[model samples]
Target: MNEQLLKDLLNQDLDPVETREWIESLTAVIGADGPERAHYLLERMVDETRRAGGHIPFQPTTAYVNTIPPQREAQSPGDAAIEWRIRSMLRWNAMAMVVRANRKPGELGGHISSFASSATLYDVGFNHFWRAASAEHPGDLLYIQGHSAPGIYARAFLEGRLTQEQIDHYRMEVDGKGVSSYPHPWLMPDFWQTPTVSMGLGPITAIYQARFCKYLEHRGLIPESDRKVWCFMGDGESDEPESLGAISLGGRERLDNLVFVINCNLQRLDGPVRGNGKIIQELEGVFRGAGWNVIKVVWGSYWDALLAKDTSGKLRQLMMETVDGEYQNFKAFGGAYTREHFFGKYPETKALVAHLSDEDIWHLNRGGHDPHKVYAAYHAASAHKGQPTVILAKTVKGYGMGEAGEAQNITHQQKKLDDSEVRAFRDRFKLPLSDEQLADVPYYHPGEDSPEVRYM
Candidate 1:
């Protein structure tokens, strides 16, 4: 296409028919080598127009973006209010964890990023599991990966379980620490009930608990329906031999009341876990072979439309074939770097995602953050009979911690949040307070009479 023709297309407001003709003409000029080639040529033409001081009209469209579920969107006033309240709670809970960690130095509550993701995942499962099984008889919640006790603490604090004084004294370096840094069954309050001895014991203990429940049921003690146990473990924890060692017991005992929710954050304390890209696949095989049901929760709805367009399966390959290191780089560098690295690895994907903006790609669906998907997976696990169920939920290690820790390998031990980062966090969450007010009342309570506060 000549510079003159490009200028003409950019200058005039064309009708739909005229725009279609322009596109055809441009396509013919570029030759139908492939959709990628045509797209590249068009982009090059647009860049040339911009360099020549002409603004090419690039109208953004959601056609390429996945339509999020109605629950995810605030469609009505009530919906918006509720959504706003939820977001505030998440932000508040996250900040409370970090701030408390910062205040009580050497107490080691600073798994802010992990705690953030953990809180979200637990929040979704808590309501469902509580209503499904716990309300009648006390259900077991085993904390296999106990480093995230602060996350649960934050949630409990928000829900009025922890008093302002209790929140203030959490993990204090001094004598009288209200809460332990790790999830200790004897230390923390309700909801965060069970504690594990070591890294890989969650599933093992859960299986035994379910078996014991079966024994009780057989003896005409507790009902079989109230025998549920939910075990929360991390991806890194899954690597331990003991993690899968007793998993066979579930099948042998037919512990249908047992459920394991694996937080697949893709990183260990040292670095990314081995076979990172294939951990879920490997776990699926192990569980299936052991006579258990496995549910792999990977990408969210964001990739649905894009994947549907790729009939040849190249995009799917790109998604699965990319090494774990590449995903680490994506979290470290952000969208532009990942786009270049990802497309460079699989050039065939250019045709699939070429039209998408950097923001669109960056905002791709993550299963951990999607409450709907998490809730659904929990519901499915609850309903499954015979063998136990495992939910492999994909999540970022340091999600929502901003550049401080998100997806960074070293985030596991990253406990301190600096002043500037704290400010940014506060602003991002839109807390209704000034810096002075935030400092004055770190544990601000909503008005007692307010429905929002009462509801929480």
Candidate 2:
């Protein structure tokens, strides 16, 4: 196209359809004439637009979608069904541990939503990425988010590392047998590798730990190996200056072995974290600007079909435009509300999801809850070289707790579930428990010889 024609096209306020056609035409031209000429022409158009005092729309540095496309995603190496079952069991036990503890006379407090939100994030790592310390290898160092200790304890219980009695004593560490409320090295020196309950400590410590690993290698104190430091933190936790203050150091030092997984559940203790804005986008700009490799896992596999069908990009536009508060409301209110408020915003967007029912929409998940997506991001992050990698995974706080919490502001303090909520939780996970068993809030464990045990 000529310069004047290009200028005219840019000046017009094209609708989505017209914009798509223009994009297709430009792509065809780029394919025919090669990228070099296309780049030059685009730069010239930008310069001309600026010279004419015309406003150019700001393009986001990242898309509001999974950084790794479906085609490029790594196939999960493990049996997904088995892994999901194990994860469900862990999630149930973790919630039950907190619920049962809170029901006691002392009302011992523990966290449910933190672990609930991060189950898949942790499961993917345990199944495919994280390594235990051993003689043969230096092993991966994990700074588990302090509030997520219950989930870790639940997994240990399944592995025969902790007895049922210890599992029963959550947040009762004053007695010698009980587990600590958070990951405290001094409390359980043999088990806990790091103390991370202080909110900002985990992120800073993990950065230094990764840097120190390189220092040890340089000093010839340890052989150069593929040991990684995995730091898990919440979006709220990132608000702490200590959490984000030293990220530039990790980038500057080229701590390729460092991986920070921030669970962007869009929630803090009181309410939504960045309620009016997108936290994932904000953090992406920060990390990428700081010279780090940032991978975003926003939508789950359930969204792949819808996104693929969004030829006009209307669906993505809606996703980008919607704020965190609205997103959390969509989860809290369920599918029917989401259809009306989210897709119903535009005729084109509404028609896109028209074939799906309310139940289908409600079941659609976020990336952090999906093992395949989480695994793909983890796989890519592990292989990434030069810069540190940070995975900004979107999830729902109090994921499966239903009305008792799920995505609510009260989720952080939700410890006990009433009879109906208990039943809902049971049915949601498809736990093999009867209605009568709901009252007791018993921890369901398949026998040692069960397939779940063998798989674990």
Q: Which candidate is the best by TM-score?
A: 2
Task: For residues 1-456, write the lDDT of model 2, one tens digit per residue.
Answer: 875457457668456567768778779878899767777888888989989999897544587999999988998989988887888889999988999999999898889999999999999998788888789898999999998999999999888898788989998878789898899889889789888878999999999999999999989999999999999999999999899999999999999999999999999998999999999999999888888999999999999999999976779989999999999999999999999999999888999889999999998999999999999999999999999999999999999999999999999999888999989888888889999888888887887888888977
* Model 1, total clashes: 0
Please identify model 1 stretches exceeding 4 Å from their true place: 1-84, 104-109, 132-144, 173-177, 188-192, 275-277, 435-441, 448-456
User: What is each predicted model's overall lDDT from 0 to 1?
Assistant: 0.67, 0.91
Per-model RMSD to reference: 13.8, 4.1
Which residue pairs overlap in candidate 1's backbone? none
TM-score of each: 0.76, 0.91
Q: Write the per-residue lDDT of candidate 1 for residues 350-411, one digit (tens) a residue.
A: 76778888777777766766666666677677778888988887788777667777788778
